[model samples]
Target: METTILTKKDVEKILTMEDTIKAVEHAFEMHGKGLTQMPPKVYLNFDKGDLRAMPAYLEGKAGVKWVNSHPENPKIGLPTVMALLIYNDPETGFPLAVMDAMHITNMRTGAAGGIAAKYLARKNSKVFGFVGCGTQAYTQFMALSMIFKIEEVKAYDINEGNAKKFIEFCESKGVDAKIRGIEEVCDCDVLTTTTPSKKPVVKEEWVSNGMHINAIGADAPGKQELDEKILLRSKIIVDDLEQALHSGEINVAISKGILEESSIHATLGEIIVGKKPGRLSDDEITIFDSTGLAIQDISTASIVYKRAAESDMGIKIKFFDF
Candidate 1:
């Protein structure tokens, strides 16, 4: 048997935001139905950043992603996050494909936010607010645009250049976008935050009712972006309960005793499967605490693998001689 090797370019050519959203939504539904296996992410700590091992299995597909976050890598002209995924055949314990997962990470993360907004935000949501206009912000916008009209984009970042660049990206997509203060950016129908701030960058007072927030950046312990009070008031939905408490946006608040485990409204999976309701009223404030999930990667990788296989897009190598 041969294993396919897909480079970043190959995977990018095969994956799309629309397909990613569908696959991620299916993964969440399967998770909600208790049909998938996803263990807690294993972590390796480093002085500069960290590495993580994420594994999951669902619907006959299995994979593990080895991903790293090195904050200082940018100083050396490298990306902050990079990843590789090994897709496997569950029955035979054979590697079926090895593919770049960095784009998978971004697309699936953005798809999660879009899925969250689909269920949690009002259908009329059009004004999208982005706090921290980095690469992740672009994918988030792409996913949101898939679901909503996205009449206007409000962007904010400490580095004005990043925000301006994001605005240019939005304009290139034929969407109207402008840079705004963080608070003003929050004054929108759907708000997405992608900052890796230990201290809260968003204020509670600024987050009004009828707003749905995607708290995207806090994927490790001690990282947070939303004010605790905002979490206290908002109907908080997380990708996973234990993971959220350990490393999501709510980790800090939960660790500080400002928030309790019982306060979380539901998992996005539960909402997807209709075990729980979403957005009961337009005046309600909702927050999706997205720590990212392994099922997302595995499911998305499955799509890329199938597309690559059909198109003969990547190189194949036989690793074992029987």
Candidate 2:
């Protein structure tokens, strides 16, 4: 069978940030509607880097996709992570397209953060603090800026030069706020961490009351950002409990005996579906444990596959010899 191949630039043209937000909201809606099937991700681990293979399909959707996450490639001038999306022909279950997935992965991740904040953050949140100044940080900023009336933003990284570069980059992109140091960002209403650091980036004292944290980097076991004490002070919410138990900030807390899996207020999905409440009071500290769900992969893939076909963006392919 002939398979279609699409490049990263092509995907970027179609999957804009606004589209990503709506797609992520819809994905959560699908989850609330009970229409998704995802197998556990298979991980290959090492000291500084690893790869994850996540396969998933959404019920009533047209395709399935396998995505991966790999960190530690920037030293070699490459994206820290990448993906491969294989759309299948429904009639015979044959492969149709093999397309690059970097754009969509970043978009989906940003979308998840925005959605989580929409549900979890206090209604008056206007300041955003990002813990790592990188591409992922850029996307998170884009999504938040688009959805929230952001009055100020602060970002920090181990490399102060990198943080300055990000500030200039955001300034060029029309971010009208000052880019400050970690301690300066500690006062923000929302805190987002995207570094690959295995140690805590923010301490409990740094976080202010009613702040919402998006724990976006701790997707692997043994990877953590904020101290477990931050979790102890916050009402933890996860995308998925089982996944977070093994891979997100909860892993660190659980291992240290600071919190129990049962202590999680609710999954973000449950909050979306109204089974549980979000942000009950102005003084509540909320933390979103983002392990990066498989359902997110399938959600975007279905969108891209259909958009490509309708807009004639991908190549047509034949089935295998029969």
Candidate 3:
């Protein structure tokens, strides 16, 4: 077996926001066509922390990935989440590449947001509000800033320092936006909540007509970013019903009976395909529940794996046996 190694910096040289957007769209198309298989996430529980193992394969696709989410790692000088992507040979099912998963995670997650916005956000959206400003938030900004002809951005994080930092970063990217406290939601045509707060940070009344909300922060059962009322009032969309049921923001809404599984409109994939309509009106409130997906990993790894192979950029390791 020959193995290719890719680090975080390699990922930087290889993938861009545009690449990720294309990759995610392709994954969504494959998903809509039923070309992928993924098991429900397996959870390992603890008092202060929890872990999940997500594995998946897409027929004819050449790689797989395993990723985890942990929001408390920053206190220890580590990232809040990490992932590992393992590419495999189709012929022998042998490992082909092992690479840092953070780049894939950040890019794919941001790409998912862009895809959702392409379908669901108001056509004339101008101002955006960001509820959490972390590293992931930066990419989320990068994705949307490219897709939408955004006029201004308003952002807030529970941590004032982070919010300020987000503003500076956005400015460095040439975004004509403002950084303010959490109260900036009133000015948004699109809103994104990307924090792991246990309590609701986005209130129902804070949402306005014609606004699209991306629920990105709440991946675990008890974590939530929006008030149930916010979910109840919107036409909710999820990546997958089963994944949303257990891991996304939809789980909270369902548990509270503010939303039933019946209330969900469609998977973003369904909207991507011609099967369902997205953002039918200019004044509708829409929400996209992002639990994250395994296909994203496969697609991203395939991109890097191919590039490394063509350029012979990574170290190749040989394994004599399985």
The TM-score ranking, best first, is 1, 3, 2
RMSD to the hidden true structure, all candidates: 0.9, 2.3, 1.8
Pairs of colliding residues, candidate 3: none
Best of the candidates, lDDT: 1
Q: How many backbone clashes does candidate 2 have?
A: 0
Model 1: residues with Cα > 4 Å off, grouped in runs = none
Tell me the tens digit of each residue's lDDT in model 1 across 1-322: 8999999999889999999999999999998998999999888999998999999999999989999989899899999889999999999979999999999999999999999999999999989999999878989999999999999999999999999999999999999999999889999999999998899999988988999999999988999999899998889999999899999999999999999999999999999999999899999999999999999999999999989988989999999984
How close to the true structure is residue 237 of candidate 1, measured as C-alpha lDDT?
A: 96
List TM-scores for all candidates, in order: 0.98, 0.91, 0.94
Question: Candidate 2 overall Cα lDDT vs. reference?
Answer: 0.79
- What stretches of model 3 exceed 4 Å from their correct place? 46-48, 69-72
Better of 1 and 3 by lDDT: 1
Please give the lDDT score at residue 81 for candidate 3: 67
| Candidate 1 TM-score, true structure as reference | 0.98
In TM-score terms, which candidate is top?
1
**Residues 1-322 of candidate 3: C-alpha lDDT, one tens digit per residue:** 5788888888877887887888788888778877778777777877656666667777656665655555577888877667778877777888888888888888899989888988999878889889989877888888998899877889887688898888898888777767676766555888988988878888777778889999998877888888888777789989988989887998877887778888899989888887788888888999999989988878877887777777778777776564
Error of 2 at 116 (Å): 0.7
